[model samples]
Target: MRPCPSPLRPLLLGVAFAAISPTALLAQQTAPIVLDEITLQAATATGTIAAPAQPYAGGQVSTRTRLGALGDVDVQSAPFRAAAYTEELIRNQQARTLADVTRNDPSVRQDAPAFSERDSFFIRGFSVPNLDTLYDGLPYIANPRRSALEGIGRVDLLMGPTALANGGVGRVGGTINMIPKRAEDQDLTRVTTGIASDSQLWTHVDLGRRFGPRKEWGVRGNLSWRGGDTALDNNNAEVGVAALGLDYRGDALRATLDLNASKQDLDAPTSLFNAAAPGVPIPDAPDGDINTANPFEFHDSTHRMIAGRVEYDLAPATTVYGAFGASRYREDFLTSNYTITAPNGDAINELGFNPQEIEGRTAEIGLRTEATTGPVRHRITLSAAYALNRNNRGEFNPRLLGFPVAGTNIYDPVYLPAAPDLSGLPRADGLIPFADLRSRSVALSDTMSLDDDRVQLTFGGRWQEIRTRGFNTRPGIPDFPVGEQNYLYEDSAFTPAIAASWRIRDGLTVYGNYVEALTEGPMAPSVAENAGELFPAVVNRQREVGLKYDLGTVTLGASLFEIRQPNGITDPASNVFSLSGQQRNRGLELSAAGAPMEGLRILGGVTLMDAELRRTQDGAFDGNDVPGVPRTAASLYAEYDLPSVQGLTLNGRVMHGGSTWYDQANTQKVSGWTRLDLGARYAVEAQGREIELRANVENVLDESYWASSARGFLAAGAPRTYAVSASMKF
Candidate 1:
């Protein structure tokens, strides 16, 4: 039972105010229209501004999320489905952090980790390694870092086949591009402070300025710092991020240069617990509790990135755009007291020492152009890229301490005595430090519009080649025993899309589109020394059909999609050292967003999915559900503003996720759960400036469930939480 501000009173007062305000002002009165009105109308008609370009067809949500929209589409009139997490949305939602903002988007999901170092997420059912993340259109080559979502100007999430343009390195679900805040006219500064459920204090600041005669070239920057400890006894986190950018937009050409840097340190102390044996009932404590008796591991680490882009208009109708980005990352990671369950259901303990350091660099360059020649419209784009990554690991072993009870911090190291009792202890005899890889790709695409401009068609493809070389510092390391390992792998695939739109009536346009896209080749094998090592890549092919309806104030869409990954390479069930074969994901989605009624805004979406593994070395899994992928998911958000009040609004939302499997065996399952959130805001005028106050509560039902399950571990979901914030604008 959650209580929200009553909804009916605002509507009634709003209507009455709308009816009376105008007349009351008229009574106090003004001058009548005269000869001046005629001249004003004529001048206004001749000096009208051109509309912004239509955004390309498809969904684009982030600046770093490389979908065709970022470089190809006009942002003015194209009918594509997109949800921008703009500053206004962030403020209205009272989203205090980055993770908080993602909770509102139906297509994106975050899997909370019991231990902070376990890795967080902003994705759809895909194993996107943390190393693949990007910042301001550049890959963060260093260790990934988490930042406050508040300082972001906007976040773009481009969905579907648009993946083809991003060098094809992710899940088909979608891509996220976070556009940080840039400088604007007038000096602006903001400070935010908050507290989490774990009783940790958090604060961040953002500043922007545009000084000079015309403010043509401006400066923008942000600084965020946060530190806190969790309910889990030994866990804690510290993070800091700073960014600055310069912008110059002249009459004919525009350019921007920016720099971003961040550092994160986490004392992610985590405890490991084994589920009770098959015959024993699973233990259940109070609704929301952390397991503190288990022996734990502690993790400490740091990450950084530097990057920039330039755009020039060659002519009134033609423009050339190019971008160059480079980044480097270095990290030293270590783990202690790692534990796992043995086959017999007993707990096995090991000291996990990962005293390894990794450093790598990623670079890319690309060009784009578009123009219209009479009845024929053409768009052309070409890109060339090079990337290299290297990892050096040495003197690490995975056996050491005893496993403790749940949630506890206890260490019991294993020792070998005079008689050599080292049966289960890790051996330090064979250690290696070596693995380097390099890859390059070239892509070209052209889209032509014909048939009276109502019918549009596009055909594009990419040719990519990858070369790898690996070496081991130690002998007997399987594939590269005391020598260099080299391999050359190449792949070429074409992405073709066809879409059409018809103007059925005024203010209404209907459209449909179909796209065939593909992801690149295989991935590097895990760095585990072993035998019968098999490395194979996976291919994803998808076909989708959807309908979109737009009527100015409202937009509606529905899509049905099927994706098949033939020869999907995966780790073998028997050992984590080898690989195995195919999987498929098929689904349907429906969504709508708009201001259906005056002063009211709404966004709703639902998805029905079927994901599975078709075949494997173990046997045929034709009907088994894919692990970690939801069968059904839904979300809804609605807000209403009171017209009578200068600034007052109410907001509410609900999100739900259906059942999902936890592993390939399909023996463990997580049931569905629903969440509710509610909030409101009020504005006050003080000393000629306006200030807004907001309050919100999440998970009103206080439901307890597994928010995310991965590899073989599960993280508990957060319980009910409430927050309040205040902001001022000048």
Candidate 2:
């Protein structure tokens, strides 16, 4: 932790107080503005001004989390489990993307590792699409593949299906929400320069200011650039980002706006989806530093978005809020299909090219009111949300027109050149119909308190509707019809939730909840006989119980949960896809965060999970463990200050992922693995400026292994990496 800056810090005791306070408005009223002047001007300044929950004791996690239409909820009082990685920790760790920040959670794992250029993840043993992430409480604004960490204030993770949380539902796994940064009350200008192992260089600038008589209007902006070769062989990467944030904090009204654009290009991109020849033993992982991609293989993506939100207090205890967001993601890739054939690493490769564009718009409005009726007090909320998404792709569909297969060796790979005169093939010009999706939902909830508010029970439900349609991009292919071969699915479902919490004593709370999530059904894979088939919407269920204890400077928590979801798979014998599968995951989680002592801080947790494929075709895989769901995953991150050195601190982290099967028959397996990371930072005041120097090394042991094998696709882990940077504030 750094010292308070300015000495005359803003009188921002809390967001609620600041909202109605004449001096400081907190969403312009919600967040805590406790940083002193100099500290406030630090490089990690956020763009948003509203935070209902302050950072917990350790400054790495928050005490409150967003609970769907319920809005910001105190952790102890909330029946769900969640984690929010703070901005302060992001800067110290030199995170580059969403995956880097979310690795702190034991229940979350990326299905694709570093260099994959995409950010899909597995939460509680279920696959989560990259397209379903939320930005500032709105769906579809974040980049579909990977969202940059620049200007992001917090990366929030809510485990379990959250269909009731938004119009676009994620898989039964979970949801990830990103909060954009807002301006601080104090004027700030901070710049950072850094370099990574091999040959990567980057720089970032953050600026914030407040204008208006009462400093109610504010602006924050960020610009960043990174380019050069990455740690992997033959990989060259380039990226650029620009972002701006604006806000207003008024006595009864508060608002914020954000605009962002970013682009990434990578040559010799890594492939995360590798298939093993049927009935063949999977090969051991190759050296992590080698490049298996051909010279011609590359990927390019661009992201652009604009989002805004506002709130108004009708009275002291009633508030109305609304939010809207729109975003676009453009993606193009020259890729291939790789299938490992032998244990010695022989593989076959076939080229595939794809180019696509996705766009989305979302909006939500709600009213929250607090009231009293006799001995019971009540908090009620009513909300409605809508989202629209459209996708465009090239005319060529790899599912129907795959290239002739070639050969390669995983141990000593071969790079093949692209065929000349590719005029007849599909290109990244994005000109054909792919899919369009529309979603709408309405929700209402009431929380009633009893017995002096010591015990509370709440019930809520959401009525959601989904309309989706997909078109055959390659109508010319003989396998498809002449006109657009169309597929459409329209459905509606109601998801209900009930939760109870009891504050047994000061700083201690116990809670239980039962929730249901409704989501769009799965689509048949290209390899299946029923390619492009769309299924009806499905509903998932979850039951959980938990407790939290706070010891002033420290906080500890534990929870047990069970979730059941409908699964879809292709019949091995018939090559047909169907929703004839089901999976249930039950887990126990323990977490801790805070500064147990004056100079030492710690954050981490452990998750023990039992995931089973309850029903499969002919019971072929019944009672078997689900692929990629580790039995035991544990992680710990700690920081300590040396009394001998006033402004210096050292930190380290250890992570372990338990062994698990990679196939349905419990055939292919990935061994358990452990990783270590170390870092340090120094802070000092010089020439009227606060300066910080930070350095970190990930995978200190340089271990090479498989990270995940969800959906029968193998994802390789990353190798050792080193990074260093310096930040200066003025």
The most accurate candidate by TM-score is 2
lDDT of 1 by residue, 184-212 (tens): 66688654444445654444556778766
lDDT of 1 at 457: 53
TM-score of 2: 0.90
- As a TM-score, model 1 comes out at 0.77
lDDT of each: 0.51, 0.77
- Over the stretch 1-730, how does candidate 2's per-residue lDDT look in tens digits? 1122212122211222322232321111333223242111111111123533588887988877766567777666676777878888888888988888888888888888588778888888888877888888788788888888888878888888776555435678789988888777788887677778776767777888989998889888987777778888888877777889898998778899999998888888788544553456667777777777887777888889999988887765667888999998888777666777777888887666768888999998888776666566677888899988888877765655545577888778887666434567655454676778788999888888788778898988889898888887765656665337477888888889888999999989898889898787777865566766778888899999999898988888899999998877655446577887788899999998899999899988999999999878789889999877899998889999879999999999998889888667787777778899999998877657677778899889998778887766777788898888777777
Worst 10 residues of 2 by lDDT: 38-47
Q: How far is candidate 1 from the true structure (C-alpha RMSD, Å)?
A: 11.1
Those runs of model 2 whose alpha carbons end farther than 4 Å from true positions after fitting are 1-52, 399-404, 418-420, 424-429, 477-485, 525-532, 570-577
